[model samples]
Target: MIKVPIIKLRQNMIKKLTTFALILLVVSVTALPALGEDDENNFIALDHGYTVDYYKSYGAPAIQASITGDPEFERGETADLKIKIANVGVISGFKRLNANQKRINDSIEETIALKEMGEEEEATTAKDIEATLQSETKYIEVESTGNFQNVEELETGHTAPLSYTIKVDGNIPAGNYELLLPVTYQYQANVRTVTADAINLGITDVDYSREYKTKTEVLKIPLSIKSEPKFEVTNVSGSLIQGESKVVNITYKNTRETMAKDAFARIIVMSPLSTEKSTVRLGDIGPGEEKTASFEIKAAQDATVKKYGINSEIKYLDDDKNTKFSESMKVNLPLEATEEKFSVTGIAILLIIVIALYQIVNVHRKRNHNNENVSGDENEY
Candidate 1:
C-alpha cells in the first residue's frame, strides 16, 4: 500500500525466493538418506529370501551284516564263514532340493518341532524326510577280533561278501557266542551354497556342494558252539528190502573235545520201518574217534523205494558220572525193490501149473480106458 522503491521491492522478492530455495534444499538432503536406507534394506531382504537353511539337517548311515553260511561250530575245530554286508540308510535324494522345496522343508521342520513339544493339536504332519533325501555311502570298512575280511565302497541295498576263518579253542564251553563287527563309513553331512543368482526378483540359479563325515560303530553277530557229547553219523552201510528185515551198520564219530564214557547209540524208527533192537552199546569213545553200531530194521511191504531218515541220539556218562542225552541226529537208509525174488517166484508158479496139468491128463486117459471096456462087455451080452 505505501509507495516503495522498485529496486527495493525487487531485492525483497529475490531474498524471499532464495530463502524458499534453501528450505527446499535442506528438506531434500534430509529425506534422501532415509530413502537410500530403505532401498538397501529391501535389497538385503531379497538376497536373504533366496537362501535355504534346511539343507544342513541330515542323519548318519546305518550298516548291517548277516552270516551267509552255517553258524555252528565244534570245539577245537576251525570254521570257514562268509558274511554279507548291507547299508540301510534311511535318508534319500540329498542335494536335490530347490528354493520352494526349502520353504516346504522349513514348514515341515516347524511342524515337527511343534509336535515334539506336545502341541499335537496345532501341529501338521509333513512328508517323510527319508523320501526326500537321497543318502549314499562313500566307503565302508569292517573288522573283527577273531577273524574277518574287510570290504570297501558298499552301496545302498547292495551286499558285499566277506570271508573269514576262525579256530575254536578246546576249552571253550558250549553256548551261544557273540561276535562284534566294527564298521566304519563316510556319509554326506550337509550341502552348502557358494553362490546364487536372481531372476525377475526371484531366486533362480545356485551353485552348491556337499560335505562328508565319518562314523564308526559295532554290530553283534551270533554263533553257536556244540557241546562235549556231539555226535555225527557217517559211512552208513545197509540196504533194506521192501518186505524183509535187514541188518544195518552205521559209523558214528565223536566230534567233541572230551571223551564220552559208557556210551550207547539209540535210534527211533520212523514210519515205513520198524526195529526190535533199537540201541547198541559202544563202551567208550574219545574225542575225534569213530565207532560202529549195528541194528536190525524191517521195512513195510508197501514201503516206497527211496531213502529214509532214522532219528538217532547218543546216551553217555559225563565227566560227573551223570547220564546225558545228545542232540538228535539223522541216519539215512535206502530201501530197494527185490526184482530177482519176484522172477524166481514166477518160475516156481509156472512149474507147479505144469505138474497139475500132467496129472489131469493121466486121469482122463484111465477113465476113457474103463468106459471102453464096459461098452465091449455089454455088446457080448
Candidate 2:
C-alpha cells in the first residue's frame, strides 16, 4: 500500500463529509412521521374491562317521513299525506360514555353541523367536544309535497307526525312520477387551537373552528296520474281474408292499472292474402270495463280461402301515451265446401229414386195379375 499525501487525504475527507450530510438530509425527510406530534387520548376512557372512545362524530339527526293514503289514488281526487319524523341519537350517547360506567341514565343533547372533510385532515378528540356544543339547523324540501317542512328542536328518541292533503286535478294525464326530496343541514365545529403567552409568561391557545354542512337523505315516492277510459275485446273469431270482406266480433275487457284516455278500439288485419288492412275505431271505454269491436275485412283477388290466422291488438293511452296489449287466435276461412252438404243431398236423391222404382214394379205386377184374371174368365166363358 502506498501512503497518500496530506492534500489528497484532506480532499477525501471533504467528499466523505458531503456524502454524510446528504444521507442525513434524506433520512430526516423520509422519517418525518416519526417526529410527529403526539396524539391526545383525552376522550379515551376505560372502565373495569371496557374501553370507550369518541373516534368519529356526526352532527345531524336522521330524518324520516312516512306517507299514507288510499294506497290507490286517481285523478280528480284528494289524497291524504301523513309523515312521521324521528331523531336517531342512541349511537351518540353510547360513544360519549366512559368504559367504567355501566350505562347512561341522563339525557343526551348535542348541536350538529354539516362540514366538509378536507384533504389530509385528522380529527382530534377536542374537535368532537366542540361539535356537540354548537348549534345547527337543517332545511328539508320535498318535491311531492311542494313545500319546505321543518323539524324544529327534535329531541333524542322522539318522533313527530304531520299530515296534509294533495288534490289531483281532473285534467291531469295519468302516469307514474318519482318524487324527490333532498335535505341539507348546516353547523360548525372546532378544528384547532393555538395559545400565545403574555410577555415573559406561559403561552395560552386560541381555539380555531370550522363551519360544517351535510346533505339530508333523499325521499322517493311514485306518483301516478289517473284516467278512466277502458275497453277490451276477447274471444274474437273469424277469417281475416286478404281482399274479401269478412266481419269478426272481438270481446274486450278493460284491465288497466289506470283508465284509458280517449277510449277507442282499432283493429288491424294483416296477411299475404289481405289487400287492405281493416281497423274499426270505436269510442271511449271505462275502467273495469268491457267492450267489443266488430271489424270487417276483404280478401285480395289472389287471396286463397284457407285457414286464415286472426289476432286482435288493442291500443289505448295512459298518461297521455299510447299503450297496446294483444291476443291471437286461428280461424278457418271458407276455402272449400264441407262434405256434409253434398252427402245429405245425395242420400235424399237416392232414397227418392228407390221409392219410384218400387212403385213402378208394383204397378206392373198388378197389371199382369189383371191380365191373368181376364184370360181365365174368357176361357170359362
Query: Candidate 2 overall Cα lDDT vs. reference?
Result: 0.45
Worst 10 residues of 2 by lDDT: 128-137
lDDT per residue as tens, model 2, 207-262: 12222434445655445554444333445656553445667666677655455555
Per-residue lDDT of 1-381 in model 1, one digit per residue for the tens? Answer: 899999999999999999987876674454333333333221222234333433334344566777787887766666666767666654433332333333346676554333322311111111111101111211111223434345545545556666666667755667777666666565555443323433323222323323445666676667777667678887899889998999999899988777999999999997789999999999899999999999999999999999998899899998888897877889888999955555788989999999999999999999999999999999999
How well does each candidate superpose onto the true structure, as a TM-score?
A: 0.36, 0.34
> What C-alpha lDDT, on a 0 to 100 scale, does residue 47 get in candidate 1?
33
lDDT of each: 0.64, 0.45
Each candidate structure's count of clashing pairs: 6, 34
Q: Best candidate per lDDT, number?
A: 1
Stretches of candidate 2 off by over 4 Å are 1-188, 196-218, 225-232, 240-243, 257-262, 271-277, 301-381
Best TM-score among the predictions, by candidate number: 1
Colliding residue pairs in candidate 1: 92-133, 92-134, 92-135, 93-133, 93-134, 94-134
